[model samples]
Target: MDMGNRDTIGRRILIVGGTTEARELAGLLVDAGYEVITSLAGRTDTPRFPAGIVRIGGFGGKEGLARYIRENCIDLLVDATHPFAAQISANCVAAAADADVPLIRLERPAWKKPEGATWIEVGTAQDAADALPRGARVLLTVGRQELGPFLAYTGCHYTARMIEVPAGLPDDWRVIAARGPFTLEDELHLMQERGITHLVTKNSGGTQVAGKLEAAVQLSIPIIVIKRPRLPKANAVDSVVWAHQSVTRIFRTG
Candidate 1:
């Protein structure tokens, strides 16, 4: 996988997208004169696209992904998907290994519960549901995909804020179709309006969605945060800046 200090002029790089980190890295790579392509899973009704080339939909699995890497001559593979996107991250590892391509992960660090914040950490959505007090009003921001487990809690009134509404939600639960980059003021008002006594969210680190946490803290609402699934160990960076530096180093050394 080592392509040490050589002519990197026309090198092709593939970034596994669906996160802010991926988009930022793609912009950096494109600015550095590399041919960059970002791949999205297409789960969202409207997914954000990065600056360079973009490909949507899954690659079938490891074999299909490997084929794409080979056909496109991808020199470097960057896994920058969502922290909770464990399956895609696993597939990326297998595909990169199969294709014999160097891979790195650009992952944002998981958010730590701040001091004075009332947080109840749990391993899964089910755990979060179980941890909630009976008959509590919950603000579920954990997305549509993982809503199934929480459905078992018919006693709790859940106000789900998602980009896409999920079917079969408990009748007692309510849904709000919306996107993020939510302001703190808006979040505070929402919590107040819904009488949100508890919040359910994945520990998806980054300031883009941190407003909810701030609002919760201000209102003294208890949060049931689902812990991040363990990612397979790999070469990784916590920031886009460091990821760009890694690519630059690889190109310079190659």
Candidate 2:
């Protein structure tokens, strides 16, 4: 499988994306003179795409993805998909291998601890809620999907920061319906406004949405840090830069 001269005129890149890293990677690769086509899962409405071709919905599973790769003559398959997306990653591995399209993964960095912040690590959202102070005003910075586990607990107040309207929120729960790249100032203000003395969130690392941690620190809030979900074991690069280098290398080898 000689995928030659990726640097030549225009090479096609298929980025399976629905995350911040995916979009950022697409834009960077497109700027570097690649024909980048981003595919989304269509779970969200009116998704914004990079400055290139955009396709929505699944490839109808692995076989469909392979067919799309062959029919489109895709040169590179960049798995910029979300970390928790194990199935699609496996599909990318199997399908791209079947199609003989070179595949790579764009992984985001994980968050680390900083000084002067009290952090308690928890395995589940329910554990987080349990660890919070009784009657504490809580900032549930974890996404809406995980909040249901905590709904049964009435020990603390929950202030959930979410992008969409969440389901199964208790009558007592407070919701912040907004998107983010939330500034530290705004996050601080929100924390203060909601009377947040305890915070809970996943370590969903990326500069696009990490401001809340800084806000939590400045406010001297206790945070229950839900660990990041593990990704599939594969040949993965930690950034778009690494993926691009691999793209060039893959072509050079054959």
Candidate 3:
């Protein structure tokens, strides 16, 4: 869609955001004189706020999102959520279509298995739980929502690390509440101190928290990597800068 003679001065962008890239892109667009609105899932008790306007919680679904876009007159829709957040990404595609707005996805690349690392790639959290052996001391980094499958596996000991401590965890399971961009030294110390034999995580790629993979390799700990869920096709980019540029191009062409 050509926005002929249109400018970025008053153009409004709605970013379906939860990742660092989304936060960064919002800053860029705001600086470029675009009205940016960031939407968060609100699963976390406290989320890192991004520049520009912020809205918390789901859009109901695609229909709700489409209505919001139409009512708010959103000029562009940017999907920059987690790679494994397939539901939101799918919803963004449908909502953008229904609202007749341009949509761009800024998804980071998936993590590749490091050299000499023992990586067991699985399709789902349940598969990762099943792949664990009995008596294993596991480091679970797959987030709180995914803990249900692993809860049934009583044979393994779990040490879950997340941004927030989830309620109703088993008494025996250890919880580490922290944010990411962890150093290799810190990850090594945590794994060694906890006697972690297996590291289970989603392959939500980024330098943030990538130290765990390196730490697992150094300590000879096997890693269970959960594959990313499928998302609908869109104009996708891999970095925040590219997303910013795409928005600029859209306005320039229009």
- What would you estimate as the lDDT of candidate 3? 0.92
Candidate 3 weakest ten by summed lDDT = 1-10
lDDT of 3 by residue, 44-94 (tens): 988999999899999999999999998777899999999988998999999
Which of the numbered candidates is closest to the native, going by highest lDDT? Answer: 3
Better of 1 and 3 by lDDT: 3
**Candidate 3 regions with alpha-carbon error over 4 angstroms:** 1-8
In order of TM-score, best first, we have 3, 1, 2
Model 1, residue pairs in steric clash: 4-253, 4-254, 5-253, 5-254, 6-254
Alpha carbon lDDT of residue 114, candidate 3? 99
Model 1 Cα shift for residue 46 (angstroms): 1.3
lDDT of 3 at 84: 85
Give the least accurate 10-residue stretch of model 1, judged by summed lDDT. 1-10
Tens-digit lDDT track for model 1 on 106-216? 899888897789988999888988898888999999988888877866787889999888676767678899988899999999999999999899998988989999999
The TM-score obtained by model 2 is 0.86
Q: Indicate whether candidate 2 or candidate 3 has the larger lDDT.
A: 3
After superposing candidate 2 on the true structure, give the runs of residues whose Cα lies further than 4 Å from its correct spot.
1-9
240 Cα displacement, candidate 1 (Å): 0.8
